[model samples]
Target: MIETVIVVLHLLVAIGLVGLVLMQQGKGAETGASFGSGASGTVFGSQGSGTFLSRVTAILATTFFLTSLGLAYYASHKASAVQEAGLPDPALQVEQVAPAPVLSEDVPVIEEDVTPVPAGEDVPPAAE
Candidate 1:
């Protein structure tokens, strides 16, 4: 339950960061206005330092970073829990492992002979 909440929060923060970054004007944009661009009037009244956007963006960025860390923590903790339960770790499983080779029925199986020869009996010759 907590993991799900963290995941959702992480996604929301990521989207917010993207939107905030896109909405912010580049530094070069302010330079154009300084050259007398027909006496343009901005929302901050010719720029009374609207650091509000910058502060908000910084806060959102910090939240996004924190959410990312939280998600990673939850994932690692879950993986550890699975390991403690004696089940195979899903995160450690590799899908690209090669399988053991299989032999056809035509192939002979070589095994050690376990039967002992009785006393006074002629021992059979070993196979070539």
Candidate 2:
């Protein structure tokens, strides 16, 4: 549930950033080159300050950065509750890799010989 909420928040922030950027006019827009007004007022009213759109863009951009960082943090952290339910500890999993089979160091392995005999020759003595 937390993962889903984070995913949704991340997506919303991404979309908001895209929208905010698109809504702002470009540098070459005609709002600056018209009716005796220089490129100053059209941009920041000659005070060199950002406009409402600029402020909104900044806020959304910050949200985007924060949400991105949050998603990354959440991704790296495993949920302890989920991991503790009948699940093997990740650390011990590798250690428990079935200790290599221990062979008897003192015993020598011997192979038995198997032979087939001719069918008719001696009807190997019958039990009396």
TM-score of each: 0.62, 0.47
- lDDT of candidate 1 over 1-128, digit per residue (tens): 98888888888888888887888888877776677674356565554234767888899889988988888888888888888999997767879978899999999999996898899999989889
Give the root-mean-square deviation of each candidate in angstroms: 16.0, 16.8
User: Model 2: what TM-score?
Assistant: 0.47
Q: Which ten residues in a row have the lowest lDDT in candidate 2?
A: 41-50
Q: Model 2, range 53-103, lDDT digits (tens) per residue?
A: 788888878887887888777755665644767677566665546678777
Clashing pairs in 1: none
Relative to the unseen true structure, what is the C-alpha lDDT of residue 7 in candidate 1, on a scale of 0 to 100? 86
Query: CA lDDT of each candidate?
Result: 0.80, 0.71
Q: How many backbone collisions does model 1 have?
A: 0
